[model samples]
Target: MISQKAKYALRAMFALAEATDDTPLRIADIAEAKAIPRKFLEQILLELKRQGLIVSRRGKMGGYQLLRSADDITFGEVLRVVDGPLAPLPCLSKTAYHRCEDCQDEASCHIRRVFANVAEATRDVLDRTSIAEAIASGQTEAMLDAQ
Candidate 1:
């Protein structure tokens, strides 16, 4: 399951991507526009900035913006940043793989095999979908409108 933090991060990224200008967006504005809690969003934005997904400006115009184009940022990357590795199980994780303690032989572990396939399918979709494509696909618009 996607954590609430990751969900908020995606919403904030969508709001930023949909902005008409390159100017940074104030935290309050993003929180309000996306209907995310301001305090929670502050923490989410900080984590995203630390991951190099976003950059911040200091001063009167100080705010946050994507470090790269929205098209360059994939849903996989965002989810990984906010939710840790995407793998549903430790044995199947690419970034943080660890053999399951109960598994005597990973090569023939039925549980591992099933979940590995599941993880790969999920990754396939998430990695191929970018923030820009997500917005252009109307999902984001529908979500915002529904709120």
Candidate 2:
């Protein structure tokens, strides 16, 4: 399961993506809009900024904005940033793979084989679904339906 931090991050990103103007959104505004706690939102925003997912400014006109276009940012990327690898098992992780301590052979392990497929399918959908696609009217539902 993805962490609560990841869910908040996505909500914050969606709020930013929905911004039609160039104005940055304040942390309080994002928190209220997304129902995320203010302090937690600050931490999440800083992490996102460090990862180059969003940018922040200072002063009265200061807030946060997407560093990249919404269409260019995928759900998988954000999830990875906030929650680490998507793999159900460490051995199934492509970016952070670690062999199971008890598994004798990864090549023949039925558990590994099953989870590999789960991880692949999860990655496929998340990587293909962009923030823009998600916030668009009816697009997310249609995409899932087709999947």
Candidate 3:
């Protein structure tokens, strides 16, 4: 499960993506728009800024904006940044792989095999799903639902 922090980050970023202009969005505004707690949104925004996923301004118009286009940012990247590796098990991890201590033969490990598939599928979806694509998909789904 994605942490609330990651969820909030996505919501905030998605809001930025949807902005009609390149103007930065105030944290309070984003929090209010996304129904995120103001303090928690502050922390999440800071971490996102530190990761270079977003940028901040310091003046009267100071706020936050996406550092890259929404189409250039994938859910996989955000998830990894906010939640760490997508692997369900250490052995299945691509960024932080480790042998299972109790495993006799990695090749024959059924549990690892199952979770490897899970991890791969998860990564495939997340890595391919950009914020722009996600927004478009949601809009399409909503239209379909309405029809």
Best by lDDT: 1
Q: lDDT of each prediction vs. the true structure?
A: 0.91, 0.89, 0.85
Candidate 3 C-alpha lDDT tens digits along 72-98: 999889878888989999999899999
**Where does model 2 exceed 4 Å of error?**
138-147
Clashing pairs for model 1 are none
Please give the TM-score that candidate 3 achieves against the real structure: 0.91
Order of models, best lDDT first:
1, 2, 3
Give the winner by TM-score: 1
- lDDT, model 1, position 118: 96
Worst 10 residues of 3 by lDDT: 138-147
In order of appearance, the predictions have TM-scores of 0.94, 0.92, 0.91
Q: How well is each residue in 58-77 modelled by candidate 2, as lDDT tens digits? A: 99999999999999999999
lDDT of 2: 0.89
Better of 2 and 3 by TM-score: 2
Cα deviation of 112, candidate 2, in Å: 0.5
Cα lDDT tens digits, model 1, 1-147, are 777788899999998888899889999999999899999999999999999999999999889989999999999999999999999999899999997888899899888889889999999999999999989888875653553
